[model samples]
Target: TKRYYHERVLDHYNNPRNIGSFDKKAIDVGTATVGAPACGDVMKIQIKVKDNIVVDVCFKTFGCGSAIASSSLATEWVKGKTLDECLEIKNTDIAKHLSLPPVKMHCSMLAEQAIKRAIYDYKVKHEKLNNSETTTIETIASL
Candidate 1:
């Protein structure tokens, strides 16, 4: 049997979009690196959120063609979307869009995880900042 890939998947793999990293020190940036132990696939996703919207996104994948394609497509989709919108992106949607084989479904799952992880990291950081601000206000009031 001949292996086949969807045109969109081939296009993404051949010309990946947003394949790089942002400055880790930037407060508006969040990054997540995740690996699929079953397939030895690793992916890193970075998102730049402004006002709760994903203004930019980038990714790097160290895996198969499916993994790279999935991550590339994910980055493109998440950009310019609110975090709530991004969270609605499902692995099944990606797999269906790519016409990925059942064996390659995990690639889409990994891509989804990368996006969620990045968003979670961003939320955690912001929560810490908010907590610190509240603490400082309390201390000033006590003084």
Candidate 2:
């Protein structure tokens, strides 16, 4: 079964940007890992937030081309934006950008979730450091 991938998706997948991890233990970093059980596709998105701005981001995705491209795009979009601005990024935007089919929409959804989760993790961490911050994020199993 042949599936179509947009040129944008191929471009991102073939030359993904910001593909790496951050020190989740750092006070300014937020990390989140999300997965699609049915597809066994997992994506980990990490962000370094300073003054409420996403100063840096990276990702590791274990999935298909679409999933890889989606997370790759997600990282690119979030960086240099405020957390609130990052929230404006909807899965639909990623789907449209990737020209993903309905079946592949889940990939974009995962990316969105990862972004939200990572931001949340950052907030939690910051608050903990201030005696009201801290909420270490969810799974990455081995990260």
Candidate 3:
């Protein structure tokens, strides 16, 4: 007997949108790619920024249906959100959205971690740019 939740999972698996990587130039905000060979899973996530908000997102994931669904839902949720807003997203929310089985709950956790890693990468790059500009200004002022 097929369950309703299983049907939903199949829906995402059969037709996952935004399912590929964006070019480095296209991703203004951040990106992260990770893999687990033991589990034969890989995940890639990228965010596009406009006015400091996440205007777009894309992901490529190789894994079970739950993993794909979690990644797909996460990308959708992160779009139109600020960095701070992205941080507020949680694994529980993703799992709840898909009604994920308990055994597969960890997939959502992985998706959440991927999002955090991407956001952190963005912050680090932004700070480095700002610091370099500040240092140049200071040196010019001292001359």
Which candidate should be chosen as best, given TM-score against the real structure? 2
TM-score of 3: 0.79
Give one digit per residue, the lDDT tens place, for model 1 in 43-97.
9999999999999999999998899999999998999999879978988999999
- 42-71 in candidate 3: lDDT tens per residue? 788888777779888899898888888888
TM-score ranking from best to worst? 2, 1, 3
Model 1, clash count? 0
Worst ten in a row by lDDT for model 3:
134-143
What TM-score would each prediction reach against the true structure? 0.86, 0.87, 0.79
Give the whole-model CA lDDT for all candidates, comma-separated: 0.86, 0.87, 0.76
Predicted candidate 2 versus true structure: per-residue lDDT over 1-143, tens digit per residue: 56588899999999999999988899989999889988999999999988889999999999999999999999999989998899689999999988999999989999988998888778777663333222223332212
User: What range of 10 consecutive residues in model 1 has the weakest lDDT sum?
Assistant: 134-143
Candidate 3: segments with Cα more than 4 A from true spot? 3-5, 25-27, 36-38, 128-143
Clash list (residue pairs), candidate 2: 124-134, 127-132, 127-133, 128-133, 128-134
Q: Model 1 — TM-score against the truth?
A: 0.86
